[model samples]
Target: MTHTIRRLLTGTALAAILAGPALADETIDITIVNGHPPIFLWVKHLTETFIPTVNAALEGSGYTINWTEAYGGTLAGVGGELDAVEDGLAEIGAIPTVFLPTKVPLQNVTYNTPFGPGEPQVVMEAMDALYAQIPGMAESWHQYDAEYLGGGFALDNYILMTNFPVTSIDDLAGHRIAAPGPAVNWLEGTGAVGVAGNLTTYYNDIQTGVFDGVIVFATAAAPARLHEVAPYVTVTGFGAQSAGALVANQTWLQDQPEAVQEALRAGAAAYQQAYIAEQTQRVAAAMATIAPDEAHLHTLSDAERARWAAALPDVAGTWAAAADGEGLPGTEVLNAYVQILRDAGVPLVRDWSQR
Candidate 1:
């Protein structure tokens, strides 16, 4: 063949190769588990936003994920998701760090330091900053055989729901109120009996007289219909909290291709933003639904909020000391977290780190 003809043939071959698929199409199966059902925004977004976001990110790439979702105690109950994911029962999970305070104490910084900010976005941002600033934040998950992706899912400002009216801190006296995990500490000096409870059992437990009321976030209260059982709604402003994040089994994540890992992380970031946006918008509506009658709703006075904050013991200091005893940087996490909120101009009834 002539030189020109040979060159033309080579160019044609190159064009054909470029026109074909860049890489072989690959499919990966990932199971995502959560204790709560789809009704909860966090779980709902995993299916509606996270999964789709991952798929969208992999569009041009030659990879796709076939997701198996186990929620509402199908594979694990509330507070059991960390174990499920760590044990490799599922490839990924939305683990609520609030429940695993002992296992992942660093992630619970917001919970220990209450009366900060009522906005979920602010709390989420602070947690995200903490994760980046403190090495122990991510190490906490690694030690559990899980990889922490950046969801930073946060609960809205916590409120009080009671069967009876609560005009002030005195009203909580002689009442048995249920709160989840460390939030139970918020009741320390309020004269109320604090019982450990979660959203799954709040309504039934209250209705059955197991507890007279609950410390809960509005986003979940309306859907759980806590209003029917506890008609009085008091905006306590105990502050929004970092509950959990998207996590993956460490081994499972390490075994995946780099592209797959990036996609999952990207999906997590999108899920966080979407979940918080939807949750913030739903807060007011949920409060309205929970307190349809004007007489049933009450916003605690600023003075009363300050009084309640002062009434509690130094829960943050105590928590930090315990974590420090475990050889973690609990004090640094606390101070840094509070500093972040202060820098952001979030009003605080009391500086928790100072105590």
Candidate 2:
């Protein structure tokens, strides 16, 4: 070939390569929203630990990020997360299924097997791996046209924080209790009336006796000052649920740079692992300061947990079936989660009928 022709060919190939990836610093813009107050303990984690970790992870890559944090309804409220992500109002958020049960039923499983495991690390890992393997999980997200970034861990299991004493199960009867989403189901046998409540309102609501008490865990209770209002904190041994998801718009995700995609996945994994580890020890340490004095704890015997488990419906099955019908592997994901939890020696709360 002539020299001119060879030069032209080389120029075209270089242009194509440059157009492909172009090793250029890219700025990724996303929004982080939460319904709870900025001072809420869980919110602190999302702002402090999670966001910084993400920025640090991308530091050397010359990848710039613009994170717009809109909390306390600046963007959306607790029940509005699914729509926000689906509608492209926000990019990253911590949504509670307890708040949006209709949008995400599989999430209710987080509360269903409430008394699953005590340790945060174990529960976090169990749910994380479980969601990935479970059938129909992704399908549920796709229904809203979104993707899951995989931090399926949470603050802690639901505890009963009340102004009154709860030394026995019978004590919960005839009282009004607040729980998230389907968690109202867990309070059924106790004969207590369940109401919808979130972390932002529980402290004041409990103090005012709007509800006799709120069902939540230490990681959340501390910041909300539940110990001050409801001094009695019951250690129900319920595992934590998914705190927040590093979700992306399904359409936007497909357009992200491959490097950005990998970074996003790795960042979520690191955040989940680090958050679970810190929360496990933080909760115990937080409780240690209040135990045997200001606050009360109740641990169910293996027999008692079994009784509770037996009483509850097969929520996992219900969820998996729904997701399966929607073409998501809800069943498989749930089963794989149970296996991982079992292998980790995390206590099995119940076997969903779908299994």
lDDT of 1 by residue, 1-355 (tens): 6999999999999998889955667889888999998899999999999999999999978888888999999999999999999888999999988888899888888889888799999999998888899998888788879999878699999999999999899999999999989999999999999999999999999999999999999999999999999999998999999999899999889999988999999999999999999998999899889989879999999999999999999999999999999999999999999899989999889998885
Model 2 agreement with the true structure over 1-355: per-residue lDDT tens digits:
6999999999999999988965777788978766666775556667776777777778777787788987787788877876887888887666655676667766655665567766666666666665656546655778787788776457666567777787656777889999877677777666778898887788788877799988787776776667877777766665667645656678877887676667777767776777676677777766764344643766666676667667666666776677678665656666676667678776565765334
* Deviating ranges (above 4 Å) for candidate 1: 1-24
Q: Can you list the residue pairs that collide in candidate 1?
A: none
TM-score of 1: 0.93
- Global Cα lDDT for candidate 2: 0.70
- Local distance difference test values of all predictions, in order: 0.92, 0.70
Residue 11 in model 2: lDDT = 100
